[model samples]
Every structure is written in C-alpha cells, then in structure tokens.
Target: MFDDATPVIRRRSPKSQRRRDGLIQFAHDFTSQNGEDGILRHIFEAVLPPNENGIRHCVDVGAWDGRHLSNTFSLLVGPKHESITIAHDQHNDGSWIGHHDSRSIWRGVLIEADPGKFRELQSLHEPLGNTCLNVAVSSNAVSESSLASILQKSTVQQTLPLDFDFLCIDVDGADYWLLHDVLTNTSYRPKVICIEFNPTMPNDLVYIPPCNDNLRHGASLAALVELAEMHNYLLVETTIYNAFFLPKHLYEQCFQDLVPDTSIEALHETTMVTSLYQLYDGTLKLWGCKKLLWHRLPIEEERFQMLPPSQRNFPFAPNITSTTTEISDPVVDISAYCQSQVTEPLHSRRECSSQLLEQLKSHGFALVHGTGISAQLCRDALRMTHLFLQEADESVRRSCMSIRDRARRGYSPINTENFASLIGEQGPNDLVRKFRIGSESSTESSLLQPNIWPAPSEHWDEETCDEFRSVVEAYYDAICIAANSIVQCICDGLLQEDEGLAASLDFLSSSNSQQSSNQRNGIPTTGLAHKTSILTLLGYQTGSRHTKKHHKKKRAVHPLVAAHTDVGVITVLLYDSGDCAVLQRQVSNSESDKGKFKDVVLPYPVPDDPIFVVNIADCLSALSHDTLPSTIHRVVPAEGSIPRNCLALFVGFDPDQELKLKEGKTVSYETWRKDRIAESQKVLRNRMSVSKS
Candidate 1:
C-alpha cells in the first residue's frame, strides 16, 4: 500500500486570499441549480467554504474550541469588520481554538448549555451578548442541570427580530432534529447553514467505524431528507457529513446569482452531479461510501488557495480510495458463523486440524526444505577459490532445465502411448526445471536461460557471503521453529486411531491385514509405511492466466494464491525456489508416480535478469497483514550478475481446514472467509439432518 503521507503540493498562501474572482465563480457553480450542491460538495470535499463575506453575524452550535467560528472570522473579518460570531457547544471552552485577541474590537458570544460541559464551552470572547441558553433542541423540550436558564422577558425589539445570519451546527446524534427545530421556530432564519448531516463521513473514517454501521440502526439519509423538508428547507449538497442547506428562497437566488458570474472555464456547474448522488437509492450510505466532491466540482483558484492545511482531507491516503464491501449478509454476525462451523455435527470445523486451518488462512505455506540450508553453510566447508568456482558453475546450469516437449512445459499430459514412452525418458513423475517468474516462452522455441536468484557477487569475499548466509540461516531456522510448532500441534491428538494415521487409512489396513500374515501385529498388510508415504512437490506449473484475484500484488499464479481464501490445508515440500515439488496422488508404479503428480513449479525473479528488478521490487515493496514490528528483509537482484542461489522451506497442514472467525475481535472483512466457510458447513449439516428425518 502507498505509505507516503506528503501532499503532492503545498496549498496556496495568504496574499492570494484577496482575490474574489475564484470565490465568485465557485459560488455561482455551487448554487447553479437544485443539484448544484453536488458540484459544490465535490470541490469542497477537502476544502473549507469561503468566508470572504465576513462573519458579521454567525451562529455555531456544538462548535468545540470555536474552530469553525475562529476560522471563518480570521479569513473574512480579520478584526477589520464588526463581525459578531457566536460559538455555542456543549463541549469545550474556546481554548482548543489556539488563538486569542487582546485590545481588539472582535465581537461574539460563547454559549455552553450541557451542564456536564459548562466549564469547557465556558470562554468569554466579547463584551456583548453574554447570554447562554440552557435548553437543548430535542424531539421534546429538555434541559441539562448545570446550565441554569435565566430568561428575562425581553421585548420584541430586543430579541424578536434577532439577526442570526450564518449558522453552523455540529452536535452529533441530534443534528438533524435540532436543525429542524431551529429552522421552524426562528422567525428570521440564517442565510447559510453548515450542518453535520453525515458525521464521520467521507472524513474521519479512521476514528469512527465504517458509516455502514449507522445504516444498521436507521439513523441515515432518509432521516435527513425527512427533517429537511419539514422546515421548508432543502438538504443541499454534502461533503462527508457536513450538509449545507438554505431556505427555498435563498437556495434559488444564491445559485441564480452565481450563474452569470462565472469567468473561469474550469469551474463547472453541479446540476448533473446531484442527479447522480440521488440515483443510488441510499446504496452509498448502506455501504458506508462517500461522494468525493473534489474531482467533479471546482473552487475559485483563489479561495482554494487561501485555506490552512488542516481543513483539507488528503484523498490520496492508501485505503482512502473506493472500497467494495464483500460481506454477503448484513444480519449474520461473523463469530456465530465460526462457532457454528466448529460445533456442527459431522461437518464441524474441528474436522480439520488447527494447523491445516492456519495454512488455509495464509493461503499457502513457504515450502522450506531440510533445515540449516543456506549459501554460507556450503561456503564455510569449501576453500575460497572453490567458492568462486561454485558461483560460476551455477551460472552455466540454466540450460539443464529446458523442456524439449511443449506438452510437458504446459503441464498438459500427452496421450496414451506417448505418455508411456516419455515416462521412461523422464525417469521421474515430474522434473524441477529453472523457470523465470515473468518468463516469455512459446511452443515454437526452447528456453534455456537459467533464472537463478541472487546473482553471485564478485565484490564480496566468499567468507563474507558465508557470514551473510549464516545470518539468513538463523532467520530461516526461526521460521522453521514456528512451522514445527504448528505441525506438532496438529499431530498432537492425530496419531491416536490406528496409530492416529490420518483416520482415512485405518479402515483399509486392520481388516485386510488381519486376515493375512503380512499384518505384523496390528499393522496393515500393504506395508503401512510404504502405503502412507506420499511425496507431493508443489511447484509452479506452466499456468496460463488464471491469475491471482483481488490481490494488491499481481502474483504469477492465480489471485487466490495470495488474495483468495484457500479451499483446503496443504503440506508443502520444497524442491528448490526454481525447483519443482511434484506430488504423486495415486501412482500404481514407478513410471505412474511421475504422471500422477501434476507439475506445479513456482518461478522466481533472479539477479541479472530484466524481470528481476520488477518482480523482486514488488515483493520487497509489498506489506504484511500484521504489523509485527519485526525486521523485514529484501535483496535487490542486480543486473550483469550471477543468478541468485535461493532455497525455501515449507511446513504441513490439512488441505481443507476451513473455519470462520467470530465477529467480536476480527477487524474487517478478512473475517469473511472464515465466516463463509462456517455458514456453508452449518447449512450443509442442517440439510443433511433434515434429509435423514
């Protein structure tokens, strides 16, 4: 994922704020039509509204720290105008705003109503309008204790024709309700309203759970539209949850005024955009997706040029882009599904060992061969001259892996007599040949070049290479420890029935061996050890494009290898990085063994190859699921170098270890795979029981 947090470019500076050309253009576009709001939301998706009109009369409810009021006044009034902005919230005093004015003629009122938050919204900003309201706007009248309402019967001249010009609402949970009440009750309403219609929207996704969680409760867009119309006000456009609205009169005139003011060609009208927003029928809200107002809408260059950095949301964040919800059912909790799989009769998740389950979770395991195997281990035993010679010898080894027959390279077996005849020449079920990850080979020609890894470094002394390998060996050994721990856990209760040999074999041996003398004691007659001994080499086969899906990285094989949920657990044996690990399923004879186990050879990027840069870079650049805080290592394959000498070791597991994770602790949709597997098993068993009944 892209981790870079820096903006592509810094925002425009302060001297540019004086330009009204851009603001006029944006204002025109924003109010162009009923849907012009969409155009405005798009441009201001990451920007603040222009405050050039001054804060002469403003109202902000739930304006913690007075940040909104502070920003509006700073950009527009800037102490030059008789602006009176009120910051009213149930939260904090004005300290969080981080700005103060002394010997200045800035006028405003600060009101804190919630008794619990009286001390916080408790700042004194101006010498006028020291009144604070005790009542909270609710479905019904309600008051908090800390705020003692002191109502003096003021005449109509003093309070009735109250001039509340611009209004901003930020109270959560009750925003729509409160805004509805204020618009309906007040005789003289504000000209512009900034209400948090969808809080935790398009912004603040990290702090709040995905907005879809809200849909589950029904406090959604349908509610917003309902509240809007009751007050003769229409819900304007929105950027995230900050919904801007205006009375029918103002809404019409505002856009009507801005339409003819357009001078900049880049500034676009919002009519078409609003139509698109309404077309989804609440699907966007249900999925917790946000409409990006920036790409479609435009702001006057000067207005966008003046805002501070904090006001803009960085749209380029890695996970900030569009997300597709893969959850199949909204009502089904993940944990319950997983638990069902575990407890289901016959098809219980416990049917597969936990080790197998884990292998399924990681897609596949890293096939590690015999331990203590690394390049350095071989170098320490050899003389320095021989070390250099061995490296050179590996360079010439590429030609040894070419396939003369096209069918073999494709993993497509040739027919009857030809398959038999070729089996004798090959001597094994399948051969491990060096193949490139991005190898371009056709049936017309032979590919003889070797794709060895870590092209030999002529600059390093053999002893140095040995030392590096020794360290790598230690790391590899640690991974082996982790693998063995998993295998041992799986094999723990497994070796109980008929020596606990895979429960599949017990029926075969006892009865058949019991009647024959070849049954030594309780052991089976077919030579229990020989019958159970199966070798499967899992290497990359010659595969066309059944590529990995939903993967951030494009792995050579199918997307499921890296991104798809695994169907079953598997035991991996490594022949080599480029070497093929062939699995023989049911071979009747030596020659059949080669044919029984299909070829699956994984290709690797080698040093000195052109693809080496692209593939190795991708692997190193990719990130891991868990943030281990442990070391991550990568070696860049250089050009004009010897092929890399690499070996990988893999552990064992059952192929069908499927279990869903419970919802409680699981983070995201990753818990879905286990969820789906669990659901299927549970449903399968329930169906089976009903049939029996």
Candidate 2:
C-alpha cells in the first residue's frame, strides 16, 4: 500500500486554495518547467516564508550555468527578474543580496562538472552571493569528489545549514545512484528534492541503467518513487523530464490538502514512450516512437515480422486449439510408449513416437506422464529445495553464488536472471531462486564444471544437507532419463517423416558414433550431454506484503519470469501439483487469437503419476533447420497461488559436436552457447551491479 493517504473529503486550506487558483497566473519560469517555479514559491511561503525573515538554502548538482533547465534558479533570484546579463568581469567576491524579499536572502550552492559551463555559472551566481563550484560529483562516499565532500568544500559551508530546504539532482546518468548515496551516506535530509527521470520509459517499469559516467540514460520514474519511499519521501509531482518529491512529514505538513493524488501513476504525466507488445503470433509491434532514447537505437521499422517464419508453423492438433479448455490429449503416456519399444509390435512403437512428436510440433510443448520419475520423488525434491532455500543462511547462499562456477553451478538467489533482456526487452529481473545440478564428468580435463553444494550450517544439520544432496541428485538422474527417451522418440518420429532429416540428427541419439567417441574420450555421452544440460531446482517465494497486496488487485498480473525462449535443445519442467506456474503463448495465423497466452495444464490420468512438461528450445530449432520452432513462455503469479517450487532440466548437445544448420555453415555447440550466454550475461551483470551499487 502507498504511504500517502487519500482523504475521504477533498478540502483545501485558504493558502492551498490560493496556491492552486493562482499557480497559472504566477507561473513565471527562469528555467523550471511545469509551473515548478510557482509551486516552489508557494511551498516556500508555507515552509520558510519570505515575510518571516527566514534564511533558506538550496543545492543543485549538475547545475549548468545555474539557469539552463535549473529548478532552483527562480528561488535564488526572484521570479520577477526578467533579463539580467551576466558580466564576465564581475568580481568573484561573494556579495550578499536578498532577491525574494529585502529582509531574507536565499543562499545556494550550484555545482557543475563542465568547466566552460561552470565559468558561466560562476559569473552569474558569484555576484548574487551564491556559492558556485566547478567539480564533478560522484556517488562514491569515500571519494573526495563525492557530493557530500564537495558540499563541505563550498564557499558557503560556514553559512550552510545542516538540513537544507531543497536539493536538486540532475546528473543525466546515475541520478538515482547519486541521490541514493547522498541520502544514505549523509545526515542532510532536504525538505524538498527534484531529480530527472527518463521520460521515454514506461511508468510501470523500474529500470536503472548501469552506473557508468559515459552512459546518460536516466532512471525510470517508478524506480525513483521506489527509492523515495525507502527514504520516507512521497512523490508529489512530475514534469516531462523531472520528478518532485517531499519528505513524508513535510508533505503532510505543507501540501497534504493541496495535492489530491500522490500515487505514482497519478503524479507522472509524461507519456512519450510507446508500449512494446509481443503478439501471440510472435510479431513485435511498437505503437509509438520507435527510437529508444536510452539505448540510442533507432528502430526504422514499425513492426517486426513474425519470428520462426510462417513456413515453420506446425499444424495444430485437433484438440489443441487456442482456448483454455484444459485438453487432456496432449499428455503423452511415455511409460506406455517405452514399454511398447520392447514388448509391442514395431507399428505400435512407431504410433506412440508419432503421437509424442505431434504434441511437441503442434503446441511447442507437451506434458508426459510416467517418465520413470515418481510423484513422491518430485515432492521430496520440492521439499528439500524449499528447506534449503528457506533455511540456509545469507552468507551460505552468497558463498555458493553461480558466477563462482562459470555461471553454470551453485545457488542463484532470487532476481539473479533477467529473462526480458534475453528477448531485447527491459524490465525487472526474474523472481526465481535456483540450485543447479550438473552431470558428473568422467575426466578431470572435461569442460563441465562441478556443482556446488551447501555445507552443514546452523540452519540445517549435516544429515539434512547430505539428504538434500541425495534427493536432488536422484531427481536429476530421473529427469535425465526422461529427457533422453523424449529426444529419441522425436528422432524416431522424424525418421518416419523424412529419413534424411532424421539422419542429420543422428548425433543426438545415445547409440550414435558421437556417443561412442565421447565414451572413449571419457566424456559424458548421454543422449543430451553438454555443459549446459543442467537440472535446476527452482523456488518462487511470495514477495513482500506490499507486493502481494498490489498483485491481488483485480486483473493485475505480475510476471514471475519474463517472456523468453529456452536456450538448449529442449527443457523438461516438473512443478508441484496445483500450481499454475507456466503460460505458453498461442502462436497462430488467426489475427483474432493473437496476443493470447494460455495457462499450461498438466492432465493426470492417474492420481499419483508424475507428469513432466517438455518444450522445444532454441538449439533444437536451429539443428532441425526450423522444422520445429521454439516457444515464448513466461510465469505469472496465479490467483490464490502460494509459493511454488519446480524443477527444470535443460537438455543440450555435446560442446565439441558440430551442428549443421540451414546453410552449409556449421558451428560447434560451445560457440553457439557462448554467444547467447554472453549477450544475456552482459545485461545481467550490468543490472546486478547497478542493483548492488
């Protein structure tokens, strides 16, 4: 819930009524926008009235020439000043002046990084008795160039009050970081603050670009609001480029009766950016400006054509329409299919394989029952994962960070991955914690990294830790068996359709020459052996109470995982029963059905049988020459849904195996994997670093 209270009856005080009715009449701007000059004048009248002979102080970072787009200039030099030319020969000797009223003087400290602009700023402000500093401000607390340190070096330090009346931060890049550092590292709590926000960003998005001085992209309004709330500030107003905030106590004292709606959505008035929509048919549509000012990328085209191409559109199964009817026919009886391989006739075996392949080709995913994994095993795995994630100490989890093991192993805390970036979108990080279990390598020189396990701690005993490892390994092995059988079934079905097509995928079969070579080299030769064939145990916990309250609103859907396609050949997902975790987009040719993402349902023929949902991944689409296409899927919090636990098995190919593609060109699996991983990791590292800083 928001901190600002909505009054039952909207009533304004005499001063509040006067401020509102006269805002437009008195709206005179030296540099401020959106009538901020008038608003600040009214605010100061209530907080530190000019008639009361009260001295006021204000600080402005990135104050270029102290007038260009400056929010505090009108307060320092009275709003009535029209055009007072700055003299370059004016003495730097600080001369005191009362600009607003003869009885009270406004003291200011204006800091600018550009030398040329700082000189102009000094010429304009030094004669008016304001301190002008030519120094770049950093967020680093210990640095001499930090805002706190620079404030102390200002010429008006002796006269400056501990708690200034107002502070303006307009550094284009890392504005949020600089403001956060000043609030957290210093004792100065300004009554009013104004900071710039990226107007091109959607109001709902909370994005902060990497903390690099060279990058000028500012933080989103929502990001600033979240930070303000943490510092006990309430967002009161926003212009096209800047947002204004006041401390909660001050807002209640000064403007509670004036500002009717203090909610972020109500306060933000800028709507310059377009919404990016991913249609159900895989088309990307931009409804407004295509240029991303933050990234400096111009999208000349209005619409991106459907991905995976129309030629690759698989015929939908008779029962698998674009409806949430809970069709049960997509669940392939894998145990029966495997039993037919040895006991039934060859035709029967072929029929089952064909059914399994049809489900994958039609829906881009299929739920398989009887994968040699038991329901109890899945429950135990989930139980252990929950225990480990909930009981482990913070230090224990940090010690097992995934990046310590080539980003493939160990415990990954919540929000560690940003799936949206994988698809060139910007949003919050995925809210899933994971612990990965990798295949055991036979040789010491193998490229496979060893999985990291948590040691016994006060949270859990040594016995519990050992039991956790055993249960997780068992679940991983079981899923690997199911994944291998699924891959072979697809291969068999492909052979029936086109032998040449299936022959191209011979390396994926366990009995192929590639497996024999891997065995001779003491490498993992399983049907889906690769460094990325990982079994990841995932846990999604309910977020903060405030977040839960927000999501509970009607028709509000919060994404647990942003829309993305898997990176490997195929992925096998097993989730706890009764949890609606995954939703698959309906890729169809019908325009009416576009933009619909239906919940994936696992049909259980028997009560105790284990069902595993399997989906085609990017690598398989490439290796199959687009005969099969990957699907875009995401996880959202289901209504009345509790915290969920799930397992994902990403089956990939051997690192050294060369995969031939549509063209004559061939690329090793390692090279392809690294390219994709690098792109996502670059974004992830930048996001993680910004969050930490």
Candidate 3:
C-alpha cells in the first residue's frame, strides 16, 4: 500500500522554488519518528516522500524476535504489508528471546533440531519449505568449510547471488564473533547494517573497561571502531538498541537530497528523539536523527551518582579527543589482555550472573562448570565430551597435552560436530583414528576397549559424525551453563539448609574470570578455582585465594586429624571436566555383600535406570550449603587407569571442628566391619607408598 517510502528521503528544494509546508511536515515526521540515520520505524515516517533511491538492502544482527524487522518493514511496506525475499542465513532464528511472524519470505528455513521438536516444527512450517533449523547454533569458532550440514538430509544452505532489497541480522549475543566469522568473512555487504544492542556489540558496547564483568567503565561499548572506518565502513549511525552503517554511496545521496532545501547539516541531530531502545510495540529501535532526552529512574540516578561525571555520555562528541585516559586501540594481546581483565575484582552476584550468561550464550555455551550441574546433564556433557576427545586426531590431543579434563577435542563444544564430521568423511585410516577415540584406556596397560564404551568409537568417524557431535555438544554446554544457574540460585541465598528459610537477595561482587585455561594448565588451581567460583558466585569473599597454603621445607608438620562428627556444615566444589576420587578406610567387618562397606558413604545408592543421571563430579554442589561435613579431600592424581583420572567437585562443611572421641558407639564404618585398626594401617601404608613412589 505504501511503496513510496524511499525516493524523496532528502531531496533539496530548488533555489527558485519555495518549499511547500507539506514537505516540512514530511521531513519533521520522518525525523521525529523514523530518525535521520535511515532506520524504518513507523509508517508515517516511511510515507514521507523519498528523493530518488528508495530504501534497499538491509541487515539486522541480533534481531531478537524480528521486532526491528517488523517495525522497519512497516515504514517501507506499510504496517500490514507482506515482505519480499531478503537474503539471510536460511537457518537463522530469533525465537528464544521473543517471537515475530515471518512476512515476506517462506516460513524461514531453520533446522527442526530434534526427534520430537524437529518433527513438530517441520510439520508446522512444511508450507514454508520446512524452514527453521532444529539444531542448536554451536560456538562460532568453526568456519563455514567445516559445516556439519553437508550430509544431513533436510538441511538447506543459502546460496549466494541471493539478492535482497533489505537485509536484517538479529543473531544475538554473538554479534562481534559473528561479525568476524560471518559478515566480514562473507562477500555480502549491504547498504545498511543493523547490529543487535549487545553489551559488547561493536559501536556502543565496544569495550567495557576491564573490570570483573562489571560496568565500571563503559568502554566495552566501543572497541576498534576507528579501525572500522578502514573497513569501508564508519560508525555513521548509532542507537541504544541498534546501530546503522550507511554505504558511502547512500551517505552522499542522502546528503545531496537534503542539500540547500533542508535545515539539517551533515550528520546533524535530525530532531530524532529515539536511540537504541524500543518502539511502541516493544520492538528494539536504533539511532535517532533527533537527540533523545533522558530521565534517570531512581535506579539510574543512583548509578549515575556511583559513576564519575567524565564517564557519562558525550551529549555528542563529533570527535573523542585522545587523552591519557583514552584507551588506545592496540592489537589486543589476547592472552595478556584476557588475563589483565580477569585479574580485576568482581561485581555483585547479579552482575556476575548477567555477564557470565551473556558470555556463555556469546560463545554458544562453550564452557561447562564443574559445580552446580544436574546429574543427567553432567552425564550427557561427559558423554559428549568423551566423544569429541576420542574422535580428534591423536596427534592433536597428545600435542596439546590434554590438561585438566575440561576441554573435549581441544576446542569449544560448538565446533565439535563439524570436527567429528570432518574426521568421519576422511579416508579409512583417519576414520579408524577418529573412531579409536576412547577405544583404548590410556590408564589401563591393555589395549582393550571398555564395556559399554564402544559406541563413540563406532560412530564418531561415520558419515553422520558431525551431526552427533552437534547434538552431544548442546547437552554438554547446557549442563555447564546450568551449573552457574545453580550457583546463582544459591548465592542469592537460595541454596539453603533450612527448607523453611525465606528467600533473600544478597548482592555479591564479581570474582575473577576463571577460565578453563587456568585449570588444565595447573593441578592446584583446578580445584581452587572450581571451589572459589561457586563461593564467589554465591556472594562469598573467596575472591583471590585470600588464604595461602605454605609448605615449610625440613620442618615437621603433622597430619591434621579429627574423629568423625555428623558430617559437619557443608562445602561445595565445581568440576571442569575431570573426575574426583574420595577414599575412605573401613574395617573388614563393616560389610555389604562381603565387600568392605565404604568408609566414605554415599547419600543414596546408585540408580540403575538408564535414564538416571548421577554426576559424581557435581556431587559437591548437590550438598546443602549448610551443616555439611568438612570431609578430607585432595586432587585425584592424573594417571590414566592406575592413578584414576577423574573430575571431582567436592563440598566440605564443618559445623564444628572440635575434637570428639568416639568411645561408646562402634565407629560408623567399623560398626559392621571388623579389624578396623589393621585395615586402616594397611590403607594408610598404601597411600604412603603412592605418595613416595
């Protein structure tokens, strides 16, 4: 109904002619609603006469629920108009954050992703040629060449030469990563670009000043932006919700059209009041032509007071002067820079949770927390991880020297299926190599496959390899992120010993950035960081190893011992990827089925149901946060089988550390077992041998 939304955008009035009042109203309406940066907001703004070239070629990244698409399209095609084919990632999705109906194109080809959901969604959108990928978007470390879709049926990739009058990219969280991996790497560059309003999105969320996930300095909003000008793009437009980049040709035409006739100057405030915010219908809107005013809500006002005046907005700075405080856009030394930022103290629990979640989603949930994992999720993560590690080239894993057990296949989970797929399609030797992934236990002297463990070897190198890896990786990442969720739940005073305890909000600061790199690289830090992350996330001050463990050489130190009390108050441990072993001594008489009853007891017997998920690694997080015992623990050595390599998250609690002599009642483990002292001496002697030998 409204096709004329583009041409007259900024055409000038002739010198001999006086402009009509309608033109003024039109420009005013355009600037007031649609904004000068060339975003399509409302129909009234789109209806404003365009010069010659109409709006064409658009891209919106982080297009949460396609709200921006709906709003922008309304300006071009009228509120109720249908859309036309615009080239985009055929499997792109925006449903998790919000929902928007597909207008122009087919129902949007995305992977149905599951046995059930895939079937359901496929049935629902079969009319749209079965758009919508059901498979999860994995971490983006992978390149297009390594796609897991090559052999998968029902998978369709978008072929280029796919012309589009408009383009929108709304891939959320991974904006920067996606920018580098996809848009910049691809041949497609549009007349306009719409980037999502991520906290770390390029222009606005460039670089949050290096703090522990806190918004201490808003530098994270703008990084290497000046360098972007070299990329044939400049930070020409910005909004609180989205940013726009105009091609040089579009810039000239816009200015030429607005020449002598319009009162606006070059990139001048267009009297547009909106920024990267939302439209009337709650869709995100970006950069305004007119400057928007602000109201500091009580919360905002308080935040403003907390921050220094200099850190606040520019009001508008045509050019930001380079000063001592001005962060130089140096080539970021990834290792050094990452370390420096992580060294800073953390923010409150809310800040930490928010930032971590953003990071997880940004990295396509690449990491797994050692603590706070549900048993089933943890098992699934482990199964997936083992597959990736086993399938990878042996040379790669050994060269990398598989550190602590966190990384599976030496890369993030998102890249797994593709790698597995890569190995799967290769020649026989390569296939045998990939399939041999957990076939032989390095721990065992025998070159024998363990029972019930050959499936990964059998399928890892098969044609459907990458697809399986993709499926497994999702489960792995979900558990890792979920671990943090559990931690957050606890720190907010949710993981309580008192079931009747009312919920309380405790604001805890951000702790250091604990990377997997930290763990695999060291034995001590693995256990320490895992423990500290949980406590830190729970609002504790275990910030930077406030306590130190010192070993005095040549000095006598005695083993600290205490008689068992009801397992004392609780402690928690988070695992990365390895296992933890808890050894206990029991007399021969403390027996179950003629075997030694465990000195260390499990809360419950292991479940036999195949679907049952019991992650021994996350056993620590499962313990109540209070009144748990301070059990003796140490890292299980990293020898293959003889040494028993495993991921262990331990929770130790001490209600009281005072001495108690168990004189009357037979000792717990000894109650049923016999020859307690002799057995104890034998176990201790064996441990001593391992320690010395």
lDDT of all predictions: 0.30, 0.68, 0.28
Q: Top lDDT: which candidate number?
A: 2
Ranking by lDDT: 2, 1, 3
Over the stretch 316-341, how does candidate 3's per-residue lDDT look in tens digits?
33433222221111111111111233
Alpha-carbon shift of residue 345 in model 2 (angstroms)? 2.6
- How does each model score on TM-score? 0.28, 0.47, 0.25
List ranges where model 1 is wrong by over 4 Å.
1-57, 67-77, 80-122, 126-163, 184-188, 199-226, 235-241, 252-255, 259-693
- Name the lDDT of candidate 2: 0.68
**Alpha-carbon RMSD, each predicted model:** 27.8, 17.9, 26.2
Total clashes for model 1: 53
Where is the poorest 10-residue window by lDDT in model 1?
A: 609-618
Q: Write the per-residue lDDT of candidate 2 for residues 1-693, one digit (tens) a residue.
A: 544544242324222211233223333343565556655665676444453437878998998987765677767875344574322212111221223544456889988999999999998888888888888887566778888777666555676676778888888877987888778777778878988888878777899777666676789999999999998999877666877888898778766766756776666544578666655534465655667666678764322433212111223423331333254346777774444345757776687778888887775788776566665577677667656664457676666675646346788888777777775556777887777778666545234677788788776678987998888877776677667778877777777876766546877664321333443233234556344478887776556321444445644455888887788888988765324245455563146655567777653221256677888888887777766767777877654333456778888777777877767677888887777768776876787788889
Query: Regarding TM-score, does 1 or 2 come out ahead?
Result: 2
lDDT of 1: 0.30
